[model samples]
Target: MLKNKNIILGVCGSIAAYKSAFLVRLLVKAGANIKVILTPDGANFITPLTLATLSKNPVYTQYFDEETGVWSNHVELGLWADLILIAPISANTLAKLATGICDNLLTAVYLSAKCPVYVAPAMDLDMWKHETTQTNIHQIQSFGNLIIEPGDGELASGLYGAGRMAEPEEIISFLDHAIKHSMPLYGKKVMVTAGPTYEAIDPVRFIGNHSSGKMGFALADELARLGASVTLIAGPTAQKENQILTRIDILSAQEMLNACTSIFSEMDITIMCAAVADYRPKVIANQKIKKQADSLVLELEKTVDILATLGKSKKANQILVGFALETHDEENYAKGKLAQKNLDMVVLNSLNDKGAGFKSDTNKITIFNKALECTVFEMKSKTAVAKDICTAILKILK
Candidate 1:
């Protein structure tokens, strides 16, 4: 859930500030862009250089650097973050946050931030349990900030109590659960088919299209981002998903069909985006044919229409989508497929459109809904197109 997110990590004065380094590493490894903000007191426990190296971004220490004469814009830093996490938040910083004190850059950024703020408090047991501190915690929570409650363990005071900072792994898990729980497609099961199916004529030769699976892979990633549990059924392609998802690789249309049908009933949404072969060689040659003939002919048979079969068996609550790559009469063909195959929607693209069609990183598309209403989109990168498509799906669900 943290993938591609811009996060500002706040480290404050506390012995637990040492754990912030581990947290930064975990966030970076999870594909998040990290910016660390260290209070002057925090520097005493952990060096700013340590966090800067782990986060791969310059650490913000003060509002201005005396030597470099560079000013850090706290407002811009606050606005840039998707989330602000204050780990090892000392009692002093927590009180400052609750009371609107901006003595330091970290507190100033917190006050300027509009994104979600999560704080993990770490202090002595007596300080944590103090009535004033409890009041500040409540005040912070009332201002819509989340608190990752400290764990119970031995603290810097050498006394065991409930004042230890939560481990880095625990904090990551907490963030993921909090983010995903609020996503639009949270708990939705999605299936996406991608790439070009190959039909074998001989052991060494086969027929395939130019599909690179970029579109389908993009869709899978976007759906996953919306918190859906996605299963990607892909034909032979070198493409890879940006996020972790269940992937089943196949080499032929038949294999793709079998894979989809087996799980179609359980899916809330299914997108048939693969360029499946329409015909396959009727007879498989046991050995390579010698170059003895000037020409050759092979009988071909129609492959099963996987999308149509799924549409026929589709549940009332399921949303089935298909794709149409047309040379002429694009709208008519797409609408025909939308109705003929009982699809909820059909995405149309034409080879005539430059930067579109097979193997391109970009595409121009028109989406037709079950009501025959069409929405045309300008040429865009596959990733942006995926977001648009996913937004359309969300509208339908709404």
Candidate 2:
């Protein structure tokens, strides 16, 4: 994925600066065009000539050439690169970068760059744990820089703690993951259904499930994070999402169905996560029934199956995902529903799993495809589970 891509490696003044040489070698081996920029004090740890020899390019260290008196343009360097990486970022450098203090060419390029910036911090354990440093880290993230979290190990201070910079191989893996996640679903329209749909018995009474809408809302947020314009059709639930999703709130299963059907043609993908009631009162009482009878018996009828309806009419390019919440014969029931509905994928959750049911913040699921290929995941927070689902969906789309 890094082949022929422009990459800038920023080296700071720290003992971990020695690792930057390996970082440069790995990136070059992956067929990336490399530009090395060193802080003035950084050369004291590792020579610029050595990095220049490996990168096959001149190492940038100053604002101007000492021999020719020609000035170096940080703006041009910033615009030339597709990605900028600051490895072994010192505590002082991090604070300066976070505060927009550009005293060196690397910091100046950071201020001018339009591409994504990645930082790998290396400092003493005390400095890493400082409150002020933590605040500055948050500030840098708020400014849109991605932080590659430091690992815990023996620091340069000869103390074992959480201050070591990530190794070269792990850094490359992080970059690869980031590239895959960057606007992956751009230009795609998605619709997600969430919450338990109420089936009315009367004006005041209704039949509903214990769905809290956490799973569906999390899925919507994950899709939106991947650059999809998500339309969230929600049933009556006490859940709220902070992302700017196009949310349409409804009461009953039929209302939810109407909303989804109206937008079904425009969506590229649909995720049916809502726990909709299968039946409703055949005749709703205009008012609450008086408590005159010993028992109550009301006629019932089947409600519209939203997922099956979408599956039946889905276009060749449209992808439909169905969720199966099962109690008994979980795998067979989930597989049966997937094939019967003609869905592209089925996400199965069993009430048998302790933390995998409705109203909980966590879930465990197994995904099955038309080929009957399945992937089972351990119980995790709903956010993590949503990420798994999104990754699977993207693989199918590819």
Candidate 3:
């Protein structure tokens, strides 16, 4: 997707700077023509030679090359780029950018660049969570720079939190979306639901499914990359927030229905990706159910039909999508659900397909539109799955 694209990779001071080498290599391997700009502080972690070799372009470290006496013109570099990306952006550099301090060539070029600017911040947990850092992040956004949010994990400081930069593969995908602005779904609003609903059986015990939420999260990220404002209404899951989401948390099927009902009217599109339980326990136990009997029978009540309700109220400008996971007669069941729910499109996945279902990281989807036409995609990473779904949504929007 990055084939022959002009990219400026701005490296800032952070322990995560070492990952920039792999990032550069990945970008080059994907056919990007990359130029690297290293902050003086960043040189301490990774040498300019290492990155220059990987990117196949001379690294820019200063305003002028001391040996050649030729200046690195910030204006020209800025104009030359299709995209300006700052990976492992240190808190210090972020502050500098937020304040418009153009003391270095990179910052100067950033100020002059007409191309889109993307930031990937990396720092200690404390630094990342600090009010100052958050303010700087909002400032950068207000200036029109897209933030590729740091991931949560063990930091160099030995503290576990969200301070690590996104991996190279993720960044590459992000760049792909930024570069392709002509997608049909651009400037649309999309709503997605993902993960398993937890029906409260007690204060601790709850009825939940094995849903991983990967499909919905993928769809949300992909739609956002295509330039849509995505509101991801997610159920309980151990998922990380990505650069593409405006997330809303929910618990039981009732909550999921509530979340959908409140937001569906305003959306340009909605994809019901959640594995909401069809029924909920009629009686709530104040405490955990005791083992008084060898067998337990609990009454179950039907949960609200989020998809059908939305379909009934759907506006002419809005597009509604649904998902059908079947174990038998997959196509017949999926098509029936699609027609019954009034969905513009439906994605079907059978449990029989290994490595492509709940609790897994990958998926193989067959998309069915209102016309009953089908588009089948091979097994792909959730991120790639997102692109396909976004493509389908774009077709609907067009």
Candidate 4:
């Protein structure tokens, strides 16, 4: 997505400045034309020569060069960029950005830039948690600047917490998503369901499947980054936010149905990304059932069929996508479901394929459409897979 794009990378003072070198490398490898702007304090952590060498361009460190009597035009630099990424954005720099303090070249260019601006904050855990820092963060976000959240781990100060900058690879992924915001679906409303439904059997036990919810959450973030207002009906899982998400929590298959049914009509697109249970125990024990010598016999009943229900009520222009995670005869099963459930498209994932199912970060998908056409994708990160899925949706929209 960064192909042939002009990228301005702003480095700020922090121990994480060293990661900027890797970030530059990643951007360059992704085909972005690079420009580097280094704050004076950032020079303390990483040398201008180092960034210059990696970027294959002169690193702009000051407003004017004293010996050469030449000025670096912040306005021209700003206008040249397709996106400006500020890594290791300290609390001080963030505050300046929030309040329009253009005391330095980086800040000046940020103020002048018309392109999308993204900040990856790096600071001490305490500073990140402080009210002032949070306010600055919120202020920047309110202005539509993307704030890639810092991760949690050991900090330079030897205090372990959530102040470390996200990895270079993660930053590149977000940048790619941010750059693809021109699609019409960018501001459309997309509703999705993901993960496995847990049918309660007792206080201590429940019946559930091995659904990671990775594909659904990935699709949600991908759609959001494309400018879609996404509402994710997520089942029980440990998934974290890859982008801003309006997550509606659900437990059982019935609850999942209730959530999706409530919002399905208002959505422009609905992707049934969940692995909802087919059945639940007829009777859920109020307390944990003790271990017994005798074999137990519990009754089961059908759970609500969310996708089919939505399809029955779907509007003419609304797109409804479904997923079929199958163990056998995947293509046949998926195509049948596509017809039966009235899905515009069905993504089929075969557990038979290594690394293509449940709980893994990677997945291979075969999209079977109503037109009787199918497209298969190679195993990739759920994030990239999401891009392909969104591309398919866009094709239908067109």
Candidate 5:
């Protein structure tokens, strides 16, 4: 359930800090990408090399390197994480957190995190039973932080009470259950098509377009990140594939059609972002054509309308989205496609707008639903555009 998730493991100073090694091992084994942060005292308890080797990432201990002087931006780290768990949170760290202290990298990240925060407190029985500790825990919990209650066991001081950090296995199980239950798209199956299809004219040549497949790939990644089981149908492109999705690679429009048609009925949502060729060579030449003639011509035939065909087979609960790239009369053309292809919404981008077309890193888009409600968006990175599109899809799904 945790596959491809970005998680932060914060280790604090405590005897229970040894347990964090097992926690990191289990999380990584579950296919989660982990970055570790160790408090100054936490480092004295555990070696950074051990955590680094197990997580396959560099461990963060201080705010900056003395020689290199490179600062660790806690805000970026906070925003990058999907979830942050501070294991073996010491009494000192716990008190600091409750009082809004930013004395350490881990506490700084906790305060700045945009994602959910979890803390596992560990201390001796006397400290754990103290009124001050209880108050600190309650204060942090009131701020929307999840507290993993410590287990009752023998403490490091040879005293037994409820102050040991939860077992690593128990922690993992709780997170697994929590993550799935909170995901909006946890059980939905989504399909997205991207890139440009090529039609072969001969063994040596083919017809294609300039689509780089960045937009479609971005959508697929975003959907998967939101907990959807995504199946990506990609035409020939140089785009890098993101992990955590089922991707089918094809070169021709016909191959893409076959792939989508076979699985369309089972999909809850479908996004057609591919720039499929409208026409293809009428016949494939047996051999490469020589440069004998000054002028040459090949008959063109209309290719199968993959999006329109899928639109025809869509069920009532299925949400269908289409894309339109135009240079003139964009809205009309996009609305026409929305109606003609039975789409729930159409994302329209115009070539007339700079940085918004084939092979660009950025785009400007407007969305039109069947009701003809138009929502225009400013030029943004493809990633942000994908987020806007996902938000629109969520509204339609609701």
Candidate 6:
């Protein structure tokens, strides 16, 4: 869940400050972009050089560097992070945080942060049980900060009690669960179809479109980003995804239909985005046809409509979306498909418009909802287009 996330790791003064190094390494290994902010006292427990090397970013100790004359913009740092985590938070820092103290860069960044803040407290058993410290923790929580409760174990004070910082692995798992549950599409299951399905006529001959599966891949990635469990069913294509998702590969339209129908009933949302072959050769030659004839004639038959088949079985709670790639009368045709196929929405694309067709990175789309409400968008990169489409879907979900 932390993949590609911008995270600020705050290390405060505590013997547990040493564990921040392991946390930084784990976060980086999980594909997070890490920036370490070390308190002055934290530096005594763990050197800035050690964290800098582990995080692969320059560690921030003070707000300003006297020798280099460079200033670290606390507000910018705060805004850049998706989340801020304070590990090994000391009683002193906890008190400072609850009272809005901004004496250090870490506190200043916390105050300026617009994103979620998480803290893992580490102190002696007496300090953890102290009334003042508990009050401070309550105040911080009242302000919307989350606390990863300290564990029960031996502390630096040589007394065993509930004051040990959470282990690095535990902290990571906590963050992942917290972040995943907070997402808008959490627990939703989505299915997307992409690319062009090929219809085989002979061993060496087949028919397929020029779809690159860029838009479909982008949509799957976007849905996954929103925390939806996405299964991408793709036709023959070289397209790849950045996010990890369940992917099923197929070549023919029949294969695509079988795949979609087998799982369509279980999907909360199904997007039919593949450019499937409308017609296929009626007869398939067992072996390659020899070039012995001057001309050849092949009869064609309509391929099974995967979208309509799924639409027939779609539950009222399930959303079914289809795409219409047209050369003319795009809006009417898209609206027709939306109603005729029992689709919740139809995304229209016009091949007549430059940069809006198969194999292109850019596209112009017009979305028609079940109510026939139309939303037209300008030509944009497929990635941005995917976001727009996902936003529309979210409105319906809401």
Best by TM-score: 6
- List model 2 lDDT by residue over 1-398, tens digit each: 57677999999999999999999999999888999999997888999999999998999998998898988899999999999999989999999988989899999999999999999999889999999999999999998899999999998789999989999999999986786567789779999999999888888899889999999999998898777889999998898975667999999999999999999999999999999999998999999988898999999999998888988899999999999999999999989988899899999999999999899999999999878899999999999999999999998899
lDDT of 3 by residue, 284-387 (tens): 88998887998988888988989999999988888999999988899998899888988899999989989888988898889999999999999988788778
**Candidate 6: RMSD to truth:** 1.0
For each candidate in the order shown, give its overall lDDT on alpha carbons. Answer: 0.94, 0.92, 0.89, 0.91, 0.92, 0.95
- State in Å the error of residue 359, model 6: 1.4
Task: Provide the clashing-pair count of each candidate structure.
Answer: 0, 0, 0, 2, 0, 0
TM-score of each: 0.93, 0.60, 0.61, 0.61, 0.79, 0.98
- Report residue 398 deviation for candidate 6 (angstroms): 1.0
Error of 3 at 109 (Å): 18
Q: Write the per-residue lDDT of candidate 5 for residues 188-282, one digit (tens) a residue.
A: 99999999999999988999999999999999988987889999999988887664899999999999999999999999999999999999999
For model 2, the superposed segments whose C-alpha errors exceed 4 Å read: 1-115, 118-182
Worst 10 residues of 6 by lDDT: 305-314
Root-mean-square deviation per candidate: 2.0, 17.7, 14.5, 14.1, 4.4, 1.0
lDDT: worst 10-residue window of model 5? 176-185
Better of 1 and 2 by TM-score: 1
- Model 4: ten consecutive residues of lowest lDDT: 178-187
Which lDDT tens digits does candidate 6 get at residues 1-398?
Answer: 99999999999999999899999999999999999999999999999999999999999999999999999999999999999999989999999999998999999999999999999999999999999999999999999999999999988989999999999999999999999999888899999999999998899989888999999999999999999999999998898998879999999999998898888888999988889999999999999988998999989999998888888888899999999999987788998998889999999999999999899999999999999999999999999999999999999999
Q: In model 5, where do residues sit more than 4 Å from their true spots?
A: 1-13, 21-82, 90-114, 123-143, 149-164, 167-177
What stretches of model 6 exceed 4 Å from their correct place?
none
lDDT tens digits, residue span 266-379, model 1: 999999999999999999898876779899998999999999999999989999989999999988899999889999989999999999989999999999999999899999
For model 4, name the residue pairs that clash.
Answer: 186-227, 186-228
lDDT of 4 at 300: 95
